[model samples]
Target: MKHFGGNDRDDDVRLKLVETLYNQPTSLMMAVLTGAMGGITAAIATQNPVITAVGVALALTGIVRFVLYYRMHRNALDHDARKLERIFEAGAYAFAGLCGLLAALTIYLHPPGAIQVLTVSLSLVYGVGISARNAARPLIATGQLLLVCLPIAIAGLLAQDIVYAILSALLVLVFAAVVSVTLNLFRILRDQITAAEVSARMADNMRRLARTDVVTGLLNRAGLNHDLVELLMALPEERMLAMFWLDLDKFKEVNDTLGHPVGDRVLAEVAARLRAQAPDKAAVARFGGDEFIVVAEVGDRFESERLARAIAEDISRSIRIDQRRIDIATSMGVALLPNDGHDIDTLMQSADLALYHAKVGGRNQVCFFDTAMTRDLVRRKEIEVELRSAIQRDELSIFFQPIVDLETGRIRSFEALVRWFHPEKGELRPDEFIPVAEETGAIITLGNWITAQAAKACAQWPEDVTLAVNLSPMQLRAPGAALGILTALRDAGLAPHRLELEVTESLFLDDSADTVRFIDELSAEGVRFALDDFGTGYSSLHYVNKYPFKKIKVDRSFVSGPNAGRKSDAIIRAVAGMGSTLDMDIVAEGLETIEQVQAVKAAGCTLGQGYYFSRAVPDYLAAMLLAQERERDEKARRA
Candidate 1:
């Protein structure tokens, strides 16, 4: 018989085959009953003492085989598969030999009689049974077949009668045919088992892939949910689980300054650091881009807090990738089970809310969940919802703040600022609702309305005085923003040159091609641009040289703050000198007193905008101011 190649999988299949033989004992029972019946019947027919003794011996042997098989089955785990198979093979051979001896004796003692026919028939029955029953182990089946049938065939040939000689030849052919059949059955069984094992292995691999994060090799969101549920179910009363939600601070800057490939490397390194720093037996998972979650059991709130801070400190360390040192920090939010939340959804929500507070408070720190944070979040959400409908409800209005020419003391332009009149909340400033608008995508609609309104108001003023409207970075990146601005200008009958769009330095952080194209296209159309809050962000000079900026608005921090000093004066003078060389207007923002105004004018600023000149006023008041200025200029011209 052919055997399988002896690999581990093949060995497993072989063991299963051997186990099948022992598991089904119906064939073994039948073999024993047949042997006893045949032995008793032959003994009565022969009436010989030796034949009677052989009959008793055959019955005893069958009983012994049954008892041994039962014992092996009972203690199967105590024996190796190969050892058990060897013992089975030995018992089978012994039983078959006894049957063969009985058949041979009967044929040799009788002369073509009923007694001879009965014993030989029993031997043939046993041979057929072995072939079918022991097909899983074909070698054992073949050996049993030959041992039980060959002796009968020889005894028939020794009778020397032509009929008996023909029977012997037929028995030899049957043995060959049965052996061939058993071998084919073994091959078929083995192939089926091998295919099942392969399929099972493939399914397991697919399951693992589904749960794993491809880049970081950590559990993904779905896997985290699964483990969290199991942990909650098995949680002990004395133990509490802490869920630490971590977000990499300013991670988008890494991807924007570098590329996604380098960003991915940074994320992978962060994952490694988190895994190494996490408490033992903690479940770490990647919750999505630049976010991760760690869950572990701790004794008390202090331990949970300590662990969260430790993880944050470890992750704050600098990471080196591809010969570049990248300094990164993490903000973590901790939520405890049975204290902060009782279920997965509530715990996750609490952790996320805490994370928001951590980022707001400052990065590289840990924040625990509290009820106050939830109230603040709910209030912010309400403000966002109300701000969406403020414009349609006539609750939104634009205010104008004058930007004065320092040398002439004449208003050069008025920057349009938005204000909201909430019916229930009395009145709300831009800072209260604008951030919510930006987050909820309401800024796009609000910004467009502001543009149209400001343009119309500016058209009513003297053409020499332009309108300055601040643009959100989100508004600039929005598609068709340039077209929308042009549409507003065309509708309001305002010339493009009389509209100045002020953008912050943060706009250039990502180096977006679309933003550059937007600026370039608008500049070509004669619209003006100013770099607002210039010194507060990254690398202002690079952007000043790259874009066609008509003005540079020095951030208020450098003009009038408690920290303002000689260093501030130096920075202002340097920027003013640069603006002069570039032929761009330099505006000093946040001027509150005459001294501050004079200091900025002496520092080389061409323009100043702040409360010292005028606070933001409504359109009617601004138009009146512009009309009065025009009257004054007319008198001066006449003089």
Candidate 2:
């Protein structure tokens, strides 16, 4: 087994043995008292001058041994442990040798009497004490035991009596047994220490792994919480901490388009960049997925803002992996301590709210939390709750705006727009609540209802006219979404060819093989798709060519804005030309005047839809308009 000191087993065992030997001051103190008392008693009992001098020498050796033990104990950590152990060994040997010499002198000078018995008994007692107390160093304990016992046994043997011979032989046997027992005790103590050290090291490693992120090797959410609590508690009163909540925009698109392995590499690179850009005192952590947090102490709001922006810029740079360049951006939200919040939970919530606003305002920017954002969050929550029951209350309705043919001036289709007539707020447009529904997963149900309603209403109109309904990205990507739309058309008795589904370019950002298969299935059933708000999103041209779109609608910004000069007209003409070449219809939206209508017609648009023709109306009004168109067509045919 490995040792915690990173040394061989024998070396570690030796170090531990030395440490154990010096730790017991009580044993050393007892040895000192025994030596002094023995010497005093021997000098008093034996009236020989040589015996008295030997006794004085023994007492001095005991004093020296006690002094060494005191120094080792006091400087145990600061001094070389091995050197201290050697010094201790020298002192023990000197004391044991002096005790033996004093006993030998007593046995020779005096006859079989009280003084001789007392000195020999004290020497044997010293042998027993070293065996137990110094067992950690077996060699040292054995040396001391033999030194104290052998002299008395030899002196007794030299007395030339059978009683002394028997006593000397018994002393040899006792010392042998003590040595064997001390060696066994040393082995057991060594094994126990080794096991304890291994267990402690393993536990420390497990704790470290538990708090680390496997993908990025950064502190995980649990680690962040653990460290953040300590940091907050120890925060200086003169300082303020800023919590930056960062989210990578379009990171899901990278995961969906490329694979998760590539996404992981990207995340790792992002983590490295964050570490490099963060302040020296900042604590960076990964909150799983594409979310990361950085907490740093700052002087004021301006410093925090500067750091957030700098980090965002660094993370937004293009990352190259596997010979492919992947570009991504990050949005950050900042919340300050003592102002935005005083605790971790409150600060995190405030920063997250600011992050939501950053994403909404447009990604790749930094936003700070304020009381107004909290109020807006409450309002959004209210909308989410009310919208859940809006359909059950029958408060939702569809309005149809006619799509007219530029050449024939005839209604070709009516695009269905959903409106919510809130009981207290009256009419609310799609923009006000559609985003909330999409976020809360209410769009799936809302889109299905609109599709079925629009299809049913179209079934009663002229056969040549088609119905167009918008599709949310969420609905299109939902499981079995194609089957649901087909079921709606069949139940309404509306032909699939008369249903046109309008989708935005944003739908393709997170496009997957399953979504493509679903679109193909619906297309096979004769449901046509139109690219809505084209040229307003990334990779519009790529999506237009990739998917089987039957129509492409020019974004309203290019139709009648003050900026719509030669450049806008050229773009419209170019799109119109491409659509004609591809055998697809081109529609120009948001025309509000005759001049705009004329401009699109001249630009070769096939269909037009805007307030210039008619605003979105109820089903009854739409039906009346269709009936009037049929009458005019009959009159023109007769002429």
- How does model 2 score by TM-score? 0.62
The C-alpha local distance difference test score for the whole of candidate 1 amounts to 0.87
Worst 10 residues of 2 by lDDT: 1-10
| Cα lDDT tens digits for candidate 1, 417-531 | 9988888988887887888788756788999999999999999998799999999888887779999999999999999999999998888889989998899889999999999
* Sequence-dependent TM-score of model 1: 0.63
lDDT, candidate 2, 462-522, per-residue tens: 8999999999989987778999999999999999999999999888887788769978999
Q: TM-score of every model?
A: 0.63, 0.62
| Candidate 2 runs further than 4 Å off | 1-15, 47-80, 157-162, 165-168, 233-235, 375-437, 440-471, 477-639
Span of 10 residues, lowest total lDDT, candidate 1:
1-10
Residue 130 Cα positional deviation in candidate 2, in Å, after optimal superposition: 2.8
